[model samples]
Target: MRLLITGGAGYIGSVLTGMALEQGHAVTVLDDLSFQQDSLLSLAHHPRFDFLQGDARNPDVLGPSLEQADAVIPLAALVGAPACDVDPDRATSVNLDAIRTLLELRRPEQRVLFANTNSGYGSHPDAVCTEETPFAPISLYGRTKVEAEGLVLESGNGLAFRLATAFGASPRMRFDLLVNDFVEQAHREGVLVLFESGFQRNFIHVRDIARAFLFGLENFESMEGQTFNVGLSDANLTKLELAERIRRQVPRLKILESVTGRDPDKRDYLVSNDKIESLGWRPSYSLDDGIAELLKVCRLMPRRPYRNI
Candidate 1:
């Protein structure tokens, strides 16, 4: 398969790029390199890997990239709620508009596998969200992804994966994610201040996200026009519960819950991964597995700006 991944030099993108190559797929990565230039450096010598440095929203960049693609994975976006809120315009353009561009330019037969966030479910604390659940996005990021996911599905040859909060270490590491942020804080400062500790959410390792994409690519015929929630079912936990999972690896870590404050990314929702699991796709790494890996990597690379805003 000739796979073109937008934002292929990104956190999850870099990981997925390598996985696709390992499976003998010819991979071309379209990334602006805004976050990091060297994220995909390790794959520089891989014969099947190709890198294009450009913004996904620009037709000059995206049009040429989409031409030879057998399948397209749109991972280019302003990822989190905080990042989107910080710059709504760029978020809308890249997250939503880029999908529109790809759909318009690509052949009708070219399969699209979209990276849709589960944050679109908003604050559904009382019930577990499946693919069929109504969307109630609270942030600019989630709303844009929700709209993009709809476009992809309506295209009739696209598959959307509503991924849970991704953890674990990546070639392009990120500390913005819940589990990654907490674990990094515990390791660096030895104490984590928690706001809205009772808020619940599901988690999947970053590597698992890449696996989900591969699963969809292999089963594209049956998976097209469907949305699947991808996450570890056992990892649906509260903030405090997530902290404890990290503390197991970092035993001296102290957790302080603040009663006066509210979380800016107050996405408290339990997600059901049954839809994806029914298709024989399951996450291989658990929260504990991710925490252990992150702790080791954090100590090895002690630096700032490892995260995207």
Candidate 2:
């Protein structure tokens, strides 16, 4: 398969690119390198892996790549609530409008697998969120993804993954994600401050997320036109619960709750991955596995007075 992955140098994309190449698929990454990350540099020498630098929103720039794609995975977007709030216009353009561009320009036979966030689901802690859940996204970031997801699903040739809060180390590392952030703090300072610690959320390893995409590509015919909630069934956890899990690895870590904590990303839900699991996709990495892996990565990172963020 010839895969064209937009924003393929990102945290998730870097892992997916290598996995696809290893699986014997030709992979082309389209990344702006907005973070100036050389995450795909190691893959440059691979015969099956190539990269192009451009914005996903530009039709002229995106047109040529669309022509050569057998499968299109759009991973380019403003990732979080804070990121979208920074520039609402660009967020809408990249997150929502880019889907429009792809559907307009691509051939009907070209399959699209969109990356959507589970944050788009309104807080339903007591209830399990499925793909059938109605979207009530509070933040601009969530709203854009929810809208983009609608476009992709309605297109009839696209599939969407409502990804859980991804956790784990990647070639292009990120410490901002919940598990990675908590594990890093625990390993480095031996302490962490919890916010909305009681709110439930699901998690999947970053490598598992990459694996899910690869699975989607292989099973596109049976799964296309369906939005699957991709997550670990056993990994739904609260912030406090996650910290406690990390504590098992870093025994000296201290957990403290804030008296005045109000989280802006109000995404609390116990997501069910049964739909995809019914199709035989199961996660290999557990929450403890990610915590242990991150503890090692934290030890390797250089320490400064401040965080990389």
The lDDT of each candidate is 0.89, 0.88
**Which stretches of candidate 2 lie above 4 Å from their native place?**
304-309
The alpha-carbon deviation from the true structure for residue 64 of candidate 1, after best TM-score superposition, in angstroms, is 1.1
- Please estimate how well model 2 matches the true structure, expressed as its whole-model Cα lDDT: 0.88
Error of 2 at 290 (Å): 0.3
- The sequence of per-residue lDDT tens digits that candidate 2 reaches over residues 169-282 is 777788877888788788778899987889899999998999999999989999989999999899898989988888888889899998677656797888999999999999
Candidate 1 collision pairs: none
Q: How many backbone clashes does candidate 2 have?
A: 0
Cα shift from native, residue 50, model 1 (Å): 0.8
Candidate of highest lDDT: 1
- Lowest lDDT 10-residue stretch of candidate 2: 300-309
Provide the clashing-pair count of each candidate structure. 0, 0
